[model samples]
Target chain A: MSDTAQAARAVIGDSEFDRDTAVTLREPGVYGIDLSAGWTIINAVNGGYLLSVLGRALADALPHSDPFTISAHYLTASQPGPAVVRTDVVRTGRTLSTGQASLFQYDDEGREVERIRVLASYGDLDSLPDDVRTSVKPPSFPPMEQCFGPEDGPAPVSGSSAIAERLMLKLDPATLGWALGSPSGKGEMRAWFGLADGRDADPLSLLLAVDALPPTAFEIGLSGWVPTVELTVHVRSRPAPGPLRVSITTRNLAGGFLEEDAEVWDSADRLVAQSRQLARVRVG
Target chain B: MSDTAQAARAVIGDSEFDRDTAVTLREPGVYGIDLSAGWTIINAVNGGYLLSVLGRALADALPHSDPFTISAHYLTASQPGPAVVRTDVVRTGRTLSTGQASLFQYDDEGREVERIRVLASYGDLDSLPDDVRTSVKPPSFPPMEQCFGPEDGPAPVSGSSAIAERLMLKLDPATLGWALGSPSGKGEMRAWFGLADGRDADPLSLLLAVDALPPTAFEIGLSGWVPTVELTVHVRSRPAPGPLRVSITTRNLAGGFLEEDAEVWDSADRLVAQSRQLARVRVG
Candidate 1:
């Protein structure tokens, strides 16, 4: 193998997230990956986790190391299995490199199926200007010790949520009432996020962190899986080594769809990422 | 000419906005248009106005008439002149039709220059469920008679803004402090929006309304034109026939970039659209 390919293959960390999202360089723009069943939300895999896999491949193909902006359209549900990622380098500028990635899987009949399409711009976060001016405050959360999660309590809802086990999500008690059949009806959720395997969050992993919580629709007493139609995440900066504070809010729910917006602040209370997605929801 | 082609060519309205954004069907997936000089902010046309032209073309290319979601990456500044919009129908489902459009203009040497690339999904807004649930409130503004604008006062800053004449913008007195060389430093702007020609705002025109204000960064005392890198708009519903309420805010300013989020509500107090964009800002 070429030295570049060797470097790409050897960069996989020992963490479960790193291993699951690792990509094997099959060619210059083609990559091979296996979607981990451990990250399944129920029967299907998490859209953000799938985005991570595609992001890993794009990172390898591009000149930059960090994903500054990623816009993904979820065409359909992605299954946990072997898949292929095709990357196209759209533009490589001095400070930013724009690219596109399409993740595909094979069916039982050997027919290839495209799962998600992503357009992203990558740049080195360290090379950015050190000026940070935030006019908006981060969402308030309870002490980390006071928060609860799947590891400390029963699952939020009854289903096969393997992701709840892999992700360290501590939900704010105020937003956790939906588990007891009494929702807050506020269309908001706050959580503290980390990895079960003790891996630190970075720009790439922040992709998964942005979508790691249950749908905010649950706070309004809505039931069933909220399938994301399109998700756009803006990774503002690298994070500090600690649990991340996550706040999600839904402003409008209509037209058989709902929009969810999320903001993530790092341990140092810096805004690390912002995301918005439109999901399928039923008024029931 | 065929009936469909004739209908497409004859749909142009007498309003200036309709005349500026009107498209001629050149082929199955091709459209011809002229970017309006009347919408120029300083040297280049407004990013949102450019998007409106693309939305008009996409509306004709798809089965559905209303654009529910539009994600556009402004590759470079588009000039006021002739341009071509190339549309690609990605997928046509029962409820939505997803497509992509690339706006191009020829250079002086006759080379095609790609300006913006957009991905949008079209749907029938009237067919959406009537069950509207909004957890967020619209931004407060003074009475229409109390609001001020370019027609009522001096221009916001010393520059050529033809858009100020074409767009009936009523800036709240609180947010208008930026115009007096003294900024609010809050990174927020609220305005009442309408068209000078009495053109009613619809789903397609809402694309322009979401971006029709001075950059929120201006309220923070930042100077220079903020060039949008990427803009995404989610049109939630068709607007009522009246002036639109627009609120723009910027939460983070770092990495020589700033993020702007916008919300537009109709006179009926319904959330008509929401948008988020990342733009290049010099922190001078």
Candidate 2:
């Protein structure tokens, strides 16, 4: 095997392949391979991998102590395909640092492909008014244990077709978990999220995993599934090093495009990163 | 009149006022006016205007020459809406100089309205390749003399529709003319535009005027129109100071969204700027 492949295998020992990490790989950066033809690819590179590789790079570049949050994430892909990725360091000041990146990918020939850009920053946390509060609170949902555990709910639909299916995923309507996250994770993520798959896991893992969910949700309301042209993510806050709950509230779908704006909250209800995506929907 | 209004009128001048220009002034930024209600508000600023402001700012900040071309432009906007603009300075060395800009917008209140970042520098132009060519060639349409005047086009379906009806109004095919501006005014632009009230003009005037053409060209087709959430433009090469020609082209439109990519080429067929936009399609 190639050195890269060997190293990847070494990192992914037998014990490391848990159900949660089964879909994800650690090398070439932490990536999720959609084994099936859905070809949904997710990666955890530069520390946190949501969508924006640039954002992830910036987050990776920041000092652990600096407070940085991903305020927003977006991406669009067209033409030659794949997608090209580029990053820019807007300003790397002592207290506040800003950076941006764009991904461009072409088809076999060097023709234009998809283009994605991400903006991110690291700095001191802003002080909120004493009386300030979020207008929308995270949803109260049952833990993945009670909702989708192997013994609790139906097995997740598997195979390539599973990528195109909607898991009827929804936040538990009864108990809204408190949002909580690490000091650095600050943007709009503190909320609640329920996967179509019934796995309960770490907030960081959930954060990385949920990034793949938007495109799937976008396909739910469409006549047929729409593939993602590109996915860009920005990490605003790091979840408290544990379980994180977030609610997917607003979904704006127009034209042949779909954008899902989710409020990701920590277990303590603190907002983390705000996530959104430009999904291309395909109708039969 | 508001200070903004007074300033706009003074800068624009009165020449049988173009309603579209007036709309732009009233709604100065990217966002358009809400014609449904009597309130005329500039919802969002255009990406091009933002780039101009930021580009000028960056150029003035850096020790550079008077004129320069943009190397790249990146932008992102959301539904319900907010947007951010970013630009980058490719190189500021002695020879040819380049820069880029991107804009980002959001829909949430507490979230950012829009972010605009620019990259630019000054340099000598001698080092650049003498035979650079553009893939998109300018269209050889007739001049304004042979085409219908702006007044000959269609009028606003409703005087109160915030929707830009002028873009939808078709002109006599012969009305095709070069957009007047820089000596190489090469790019894509079409107009008989304005309340459909036939008026004929050159390219620069069109640039200042067509800013009102929302990004609906991809969906309804050029013959039809739709509202644009955001507009992005990259000025690669400025035409010689005069009228230029723009060949309109639609790249792709899917789901309920559309993207129109236009190449503005000079009379000599040299490319000047690349323009593209994402528009939200209104559905029944």
* Candidate topping TM-score: 1
Q: Which candidate wins on DockQ?
A: 1
Provide the interface RMSD of candidate 1 in angstroms, 1 decimal place: 1.1
Q: Chain B TM-score in candidate 1, rounded to 2 decimals?
A: 0.93
Error of 2 at A166 (Å): 18
- Each prediction's TM-score versus the true structure: 0.93, 0.39
C-alpha-based local distance difference test score of model 1: 0.84
Interface RMSD for each predicted structure:
1.1, 17.0
lDDT of 2 at A10: 22
Individual DockQ of the candidates? 0.67, 0.02
Question: Lowest summed-lDDT stretch of 10 residues in model 1 chain B?
Answer: B1-10
State how far residue B223 of model 1 sits from its true place (Å): 0.6
| Fraction of the reference Cα-Cα interface contacts (below 8 Å) that each candidate reproduces | 0.66, 0.00
